[model samples]
Target: MSNQLFIPPNYKPVLNTTRTEKAIKLTKDLFENQLSAELRLRRVTAPLFVLKGTGINDDLNGTERPVSFPIKCMQETRAEIVHSLAKWKRWNLKKLQITEGFGLYTDMNAIRPDEDLDNIHSLYVDQWDWERVITPEERNLKFLKRVVRKIYSVMKRTEYLLYEEYPELVPQLPDNITFIQAQDLQDQYPGLNSKEKEDRAAKEFGAIFVIGIGGALANGEKHDGRAPDYDDWTTPSEGNYKGLNGDIVVWNNVLQRSFELSSMGIRVDAPALLKQLAIANSEDRAKLMWHQMLLNGELPQTIGGGIGQSRLCMFFLRKAHIGEVQSSIWPESVIEVCEKNNIPLF
Candidate 1:
């Protein structure tokens, strides 16, 4: 998909350029500080591109090709733009010798050339990629839920602060979040598709954590595609529940749709890694440097995920188009539509 631009009738930005700039800075600063304190994370430097074929780059859903180039200065070694810092963060946790409760976070920027340029999607991706080392006992469904709750709480606090600062802005998040399993949602709306189910649930709950991604539901179809190596989506919890990972989504009143804010989970261990790699039919990945280290128990047991920076800004600012929040190349058609609707793309 190239572009999927949409502008509501009589749409206008809540904040003008000057106010939007101020709000964006406040959002980033407050959210980063709150998230780091809540998760016990320290900010770290991240790479824009990494050496190719080392299995350090995130494959995403395992199909999207990364932007790559040959480095002449480095003897023609190929370098690939990072899809995400998923795998690299684990390596960092190990190398940095981070404590069990401490982790790292960074401002990750990437170019998703194939991203659908829609109201919420963009080619230029920016996110707060974070990872934290955890004890083996902390690698459970309960722990995952606790972390999700903490992150959600911080998000709500950030929203409150923003609202206090800019009285014109209103809070769109709920005080509490609802949790549901993927299979339960499928059962609730057997006739609807996965996305439709998400929309319905998010709309009703105001905020939700839809658990069990990257694995098949009761209908033998996955709710969404997730990279197997990073999240333990196939593992079963202590009881009947499955998957220690899920997505944080909220209803977008402006777009009148479900909006995803984050995808997080417990990192895959050695056993889970082998199982997931085989399920993905990419067992050859085990031979790669990062994969080898994981299989050998050289990496730390961690939980991490990326929170979309621009998407959050767009949501908070109630902008109809993602281009309004981030400066990125857009199709001429999209430009025309935004201009017609009085949306100023940054």
Candidate 2:
């Protein structure tokens, strides 16, 4: 999410320009180490493009189109660049039959045509996506909290390692994460919209999870929009983390503010998927052929999510510009800012 932070003007790089390359490589390695150790995730190859109507698309907030084109090799197949591997991971888990506790992580690359490019967001999206099979017992609030704690633990561990390896990489992550139910947050500050509450809370308490998502608020408003498939909207808060400012969460939960680093939950079983589809008024999708497999329990029951690699790097590096580390084109305003601040863009 966009958060305002103090930037030092004319602050030239102390380290050589080569650090960007080294930084990205180290970031991948460090993140991989934590993910593999914590989630038992094994690296795998993922699709740059999946067949159209395959239900392999990431419907971020139920909007945004996939970058797609017709493939001649498969004449009938219209392949689209994956928005994220949220659905693909679940399918792979069953296709691969990955056992419980064993999971797969892929370096997912995507083009999000609708993404409003910000300091942290790029048209060229890249991140780590992982999914692991879970037993039926691991689907309650307690189980979810336990998994959240484990994920945070890995992040803490990774932060420590990064600090040690690159002393210049100064990141101050709070040891204790603040977990708040989406409804509780609304209840605490009903007067304020979602972003206001998130900013108020996370600013005071470091990392926070704003639960109670997918549906409308008490006033019949969505805490935030989320797609109906893949995730059981009834069970967990599909809207996850929203980081704090000093952080740019300027406006409330309007189109102005978005803070969901991960959209993970226990994947819906066949029963749950059908129910959610009906609720979302998307039952028609059930007949989409690709969804037929999922409806028949042909997919694995697992938990999966995507993590923003650039955001983590930017936060840790204390660099105001994400372009400093990631090799992506910058908007003119951002580019001007980079040049003005003498912060070299990679």
Candidate 3:
């Protein structure tokens, strides 16, 4: 949450403003098409907000407050701008009768008013939210790893495409992504904090998926917080592990830090939902319509996640600040730092 801006010494943008704008468009288009094809996902329309009290909106980390306002159309009922469409995508799968192995992806734009804006974090969020129906038996670590590899492949391919378009932007991603459990990472770097551990892992592997997020580790601390209802973070995975969810992190040579591009996992089933809800002291959510449908077997079993669009562009294009790729408000302090550092804000 530190607002301190870190600009690498002698940093220079690879593309000018006009070309950066064009590259952003190309990156989004190229990645989206390739991702959809690789995952068998059909692009679908998504909503910016959902009715309050429906348990449909993502309770990211179960802490950050969502931006909500009264809607005059429905007797002024409150509506909350979605943090992410984690649950809604699963609901959509059932509504559309999307068969197994097939899924949907949407351009999800959101406002995270509580986000601590930094070189990477932004108040405005844009990502590719995707979900696919899965069979009951396919909810294991092996299956989750398979999906992660597919997404990583799409990312690598997109990097190559960008290289082809802009020769100055050379591809740096490794051929394959390394996977490690969060507990193992914690054990490896017991003295380091969570972020430090991720930094070490990413730097060492270039790219890695830190599994078992949200759930408590051996030390009774979570690697990071995840909303209980969306990702299955309490299931017993491999030896001593407890979740099927994780994050895709890579070493950002531009920032000299670990950069997270996505968070995804298998959607919680009825048992995992109830267990995680209780663990989170949020069993009351079971009464909401979305929860009711899930508990009653009305929703489909699925795996889904969100890949940050702006983050991808920033990383691939070697920008120092996220503002270089997407337009968003920034505090005067951040603006001053970037201005002094020659890191233009769009």
lDDT top scorer: 3
**How big is the positional error of residue 37 in model 2, measured in Å on the Cα after superposition?**
1.7
Question: How would you encode candidate 1's per-residue C-alpha lDDT over 274-346 as one tens digit per residue?
Answer: 9889889989999999999998889999999999999888888888878877899988877877787898988
Writing each residue's lDDT as its tens digit, candidate 3 over 35-105 gives 99999999999999999999999999888899999988889999999999999999999999999999999
**Global Cα RMSD, each model:** 1.2, 5.1, 1.0
* Candidate 1 TM-score, C-alpha based: 0.98
**Tens digits of per-residue lDDT for model 2, 221-298:** 666676777665565433442211011111112122334445566666777678778878888888876579887767
Clashing pairs in 1: none
- Comparing 1 with 2 on lDDT, the higher-scoring candidate is 1
lDDT of each: 0.90, 0.68, 0.94
TM-score for every candidate vs. truth? 0.98, 0.86, 0.99
